[model samples]
Target: MAQPIIEFKNFGFQYDAQAEPTLYNIDLAIQPGERVLIAGPSGSGKSTIASCINGLIPFSYPGRCTGSLTVDGVDAPNASIFELSKHVGTVLQDPDGQFIGLTVGEDIAFALENQCVAQPEMKQTVERVARLVDVENLLEQEPHALSGGQKQRVSLAGVMVDDVKVLLFDEPLANLDPAAGKQTIELIDQVQQKTGATVIIIEHRLEDVLWRSVDRIVLMGEGRILADTTPEALLAGNQLAENGIREPLYITALKYAGVSLEAEKKPAHVDTLRLTEQDKAAVRTWYQQTVARPQAPAAAPLLEVKDLCFGYSEGVTNLRDVSFTLNEGDMVSIVGRNGAGKSTLAKLICGFETPRSGSVWLNGRNLEGDTIKERAAHIGYVMQNPNQMISQSLIFDEVALGLRTAKLPEDEVERRVNEALTICGLYPFRKWPVSALSFGQKKRVTIASVLVMQPKVLILDEPTAGQDFRHYTEIMEFLRSLNQKGYTVIMVTHDMHLMLEYTSRALVFNQSRMIGDLTPAELLCDSTLVEQAALKETSLFTLAQKCGIQPPEAFVQHFIDYDREVRDKWQTV
Candidate 1:
C-alpha cells in the first residue's frame, strides 16, 4: 500500500477571516506513484484541500484546523512550508505568477541554487529535467515572453528539479489552446511515468483531463467528498451531473442515444471504451431520426472592418489584413491558438488601439473620429477576468457606474441598472456586496455593467474560461438570450464545445490572418483547417465515424441542434 503518501483523516480548515470552514470532514488518501484528479464546481473547497496538502493553510493562510493531515510522512499542520517544500512541489494555475528568474534556464535552476548544489551537478540536473519536459531549446528565452504552454512546461521543470515526491498541478490547462492543452496532458503523463512521483491535479475540465488515463477521480462539492472512485465507476453514475461536473463528450453522446453505460466496459476513455452492436445501432438510429433546425437568415451588416492591419512594433504585426463584417443579431466566435490576434482584433474595434492601415465602420458610420469613450456607446468589450472590469463594491453601483458617469437622470439610471440586472439574473441581489457573489455571479455582474451601456455589439474575451459545465451553460445561455434580443455578440474564446454548441458562426485565425470564416460544424469537419487553427476535433466526429454515420459533419450539426432543443425545453420547464 506504500503507506499512502498523503492522507487526510476527517480534516477540516477555516481561514481566520472566514466564519465557516471551507472543508468539512474530508477523508482522502493518495498512494505513492498514483495519478489522481480532484474536480468540483466553484466554491467546492477543492482549492482549500490543495492548500492543506501544500502546507499553505496553517503556514501561509493562518487558519484553524481540525482532525489531522499528513503529506509525504510529515505532519502537515506542524511542518513548516520550507520543510514541506522538500517533499511536495506545486504548479500554480497561472504560470506567470510563479516565475522568479528572467530566463528559462535560470528559473529551472533557482531551486537547486537555493540548496547550494555544486554548479556542475545543478547544470546536469537542470538540463536533464528541461529535456524531460521538452523545454531544452527554450533555456535561454525569457520566461514571461514564452507562450502559455511553454510557460507551463517551464513551471513543471522548475518544480521537477527539486526531486519532490509529490506533484500538485492547479488548473494547468486554464489558459492554453487546444493543441497546447493536449500536449500538456501528454507531457504530464510522461513526467509522472519517468519520475514515478505521486501526482494530484485540480481542474474543472474533466473531459480534457481524461485525455490521459487517471487511476482515480475525487469529486468534491460543498466542502465534502461526494465520490472517490475510479474514472470508469464515476462516469457510469450520475454523480458528475449531480455535482455540476462535465463528463467526457462521447459518454454524453452515448447517454443521449439511450445506450446504457457499464463500468466494466470502461466508459472513461473514448479510445478503450467497449461498444457493442446494440450501442452502435442506438447511436445510428438516433442520428438518422434527428433533424437539424434551419439556421436563421443573416441580418444586415452592423460593424465592418476594412483591410485592418496593426502592429505594436515596427516589424511585429499583431493583425495583418484582417477583415470581417459582424451583422446585426449575430453570435460569432473568434477562435485560434494563443497569440493569434483574437484579442488584438477586439481592441482595434473598441478603439483602444489604432490600426496602421484600416478603417472601422459602425452602421455605415466611420468610427475613426470616435474616442475610446465614444466607441463605448456602440461596442462593449468584457474582459476575461471579471475582476479587471468590476470597480464598485455593490452590485447596483457597479452596474450603474457607466450610466451615472454619463450624467443620466437619477430615475433613468435606476431604470437602466434595474433592467440590466434583471437580464443578467442579478436584480434580486442588486444591493448585495460584490465580494459576496460567486465567480459566475461576478462575471454576470460584469456583463450587466456592460449591458447597461446600451451597446449594439457585445464582445467577450473567453467568457467561460474557468467555469464548470453547469456555470458554462448558464453563462452561454444568458449570452444566447442577449443575442436573441438583437445584440450582436462576438466571443474571443478557446473553448471548442462552446463554439460548436452555442455559436453558429466561427472566425478562425492563424498566423495573424483570418484563415477560415465558416459555420462551427464546417470548421470542425475540416481536419486540415482545424489543425492549422490549432483546434482539436470534437469527439462527436470520431463517435459518428464509429457508428457508421455518413458525413460526420451532418451528425455533429444534428447533435448541436438536438442538444440546444433539449436545453431550450429544460429552461422552459
Candidate 2:
C-alpha cells in the first residue's frame, strides 16, 4: 500500500494574538493521488488547515502549532515554505494576488527560474504547463488583465509548472461565474489525474466542487473535523446543515418535502440522486400544499436609463446603449459572465462613472451631472470587495458613520444603527473590532452601514460571495424585507440560487450588452439564453431532467415557487 501523501495527528492551531485555538484536534490522512475537499462555513478553520499543509502556519502566520502534520514525508511546521513548495503547490482564492510576473509566461516560469533551471528547459516547461492548463494563448497577455477564469488558469499553470506532488486550491471557485467555476473544477480534476498528485480543495461551494468526483469530503465546523467520509454518505443526512454547511439545494428541497434518502439507493453523485415514485409523489403533494405569495404590482419607475454608453477608452465599450427601467420596490438581479459588465452598470447607475453618451434619470431628474456622493443619498452601492467599503475600526462605528455624518441626533443615530445591525444579524458583534471579523461578517457590516441610510435603491455586488448558507439566507431575507418595505434592490451576482430564490427579475448581460430582461424562470429555462449568458442551468432544473420528469421546465418552476413559499413562511416564523 502507498504511504499517505498528507497526514495530520491531533493537530491544533492558534494564532499568537488569539486566546483560543482556531483548529482543534484534527486527524486526517490522504493517500497518494487522492482528491479531497475540505469544506465548511467562513471562519470554520478550513483555510487554516490549508495554510498548515502549505507551511503557511507557524512560518508565515505567526501561529502556535501543535501535534504532527506531514506533507509528502516532511514535517510541515518545521519545514520552510520553500522546502514545502517543492512538494506542495498552493493556488490562492484571488488569482491576482498570486501573480508576481508581468505576463502569463513569466509567471509560469517563475518557480523554474528560482530553481535555476536552464533557460531552454524553463521555456519548454512554461510552454508545456501553459498548454496543459489551456492558457497557451494567454501567455503573452498581462496576468492581471485576463478574466477571472483565465487568471485562475494562469495561476494553475504557474503552480503546476513545478510538477509538485500535492496541489492545494483555496476557495478556487469563490470569484468565478457559474460556467467558469464549473470549468475550473473540471480543470482541477484533469490536472490531478494527469499529474497523479494528491489534491486538496478548500471551498464553501461543496456542490460546485462536486461537479467532478472527489475521493473524500472533510466537513469542518467551529475548529474541528466533524465528518470525513464519501460524498454519498456525507450528503445523505442533515450533517451539512447541522454543521452550518450548505448541502445542495435539490437535497434541501427533497428533505423539505419529507422524502427519505435513507430508503433510496445511494447514488454516487448528487446529479445521479434518484427519487422513488413515492418520493416524487410526496414532492408533488408538497408543491400542491404550498402557495406562492403573489408580488405586489410595481409602482412608477424610480430609476431609468436611456441609451447608456460608457467605456474606459474609445474602442473599449463596457456598456453599449444599455437601457433599463427599475420601478419602485423592484428586486432585480444583474447576472452574466465574469466580464459581462454587471459591475460597470452598477457604477454607472451610482454615478461613480459618467456615461460618455445617454442619460440616467432618478425620479425624473437627470443624474448625468450628479457626483458619487450626491447620488449616495438615493442609491447605496456596496462593492463586492467589502475591504473597499470598510473604513471604520469598530463595527458599531462603521455602521453608524453614515448617520453620524449626516449630523443626525445622537438618539436617532443610536436607534437607526442598532436597528440596521439587528437586521443584518450583526448586533451581537457590534462592539467587536472590524479587523477581527471574517470576510462574511465584514460584508454584513458594510451592508448594515448602507441599510442605516435607508436609500431608495440598494445595489449590492455579489453580496453573498464568500458567505455561508446561514449568512447568505439572512442577508437575502433582509434584502427581501427591505424590498417589501419599498426599497428597490439591484444585485450584481453570479449565484444562480440567489437569482432564482430571491430576485423577481434578471437583467442578463453578455459582451457588454443587455441581451435579455426577463423573469428568472424565463432566463433559466431557456438553454440558449443560459449558454449565451455563460450561466449554468440550476441544479434543480437538471434534477428534474435526470428524474425523467415530463415538462421539466414546469417542474423547475414548481420547485422554485415551492421553495419561495417555504422560505417566506419560515422567515415569518
Using TM-score, give the best candidate's number.
Answer: 1
For residues 229-314, could you state the per-residue lDDT of candidate 2 as single tens digits? 88888778778888878778778767877887761545345566777888777776665664565857849989998999999887
Q: lDDT, candidate 1, residue 4?
A: 94
lDDT of 1 at 25: 95
Q: List the residue pairs that clash in candidate 1.
A: none
lDDT of 1 by residue, 275-369 (tens): 89999999998888755586688689999998999999998998999888888998999999899999999999999999999899999999999
Error of 1 at 210 (Å): 1.0
Where in model 1 is the C-alpha error above 4 Å?
292-294
Off by over 4 Å in 2: 262-270, 395-433, 436-438, 548-550, 571-573
TM-score of 2: 0.93
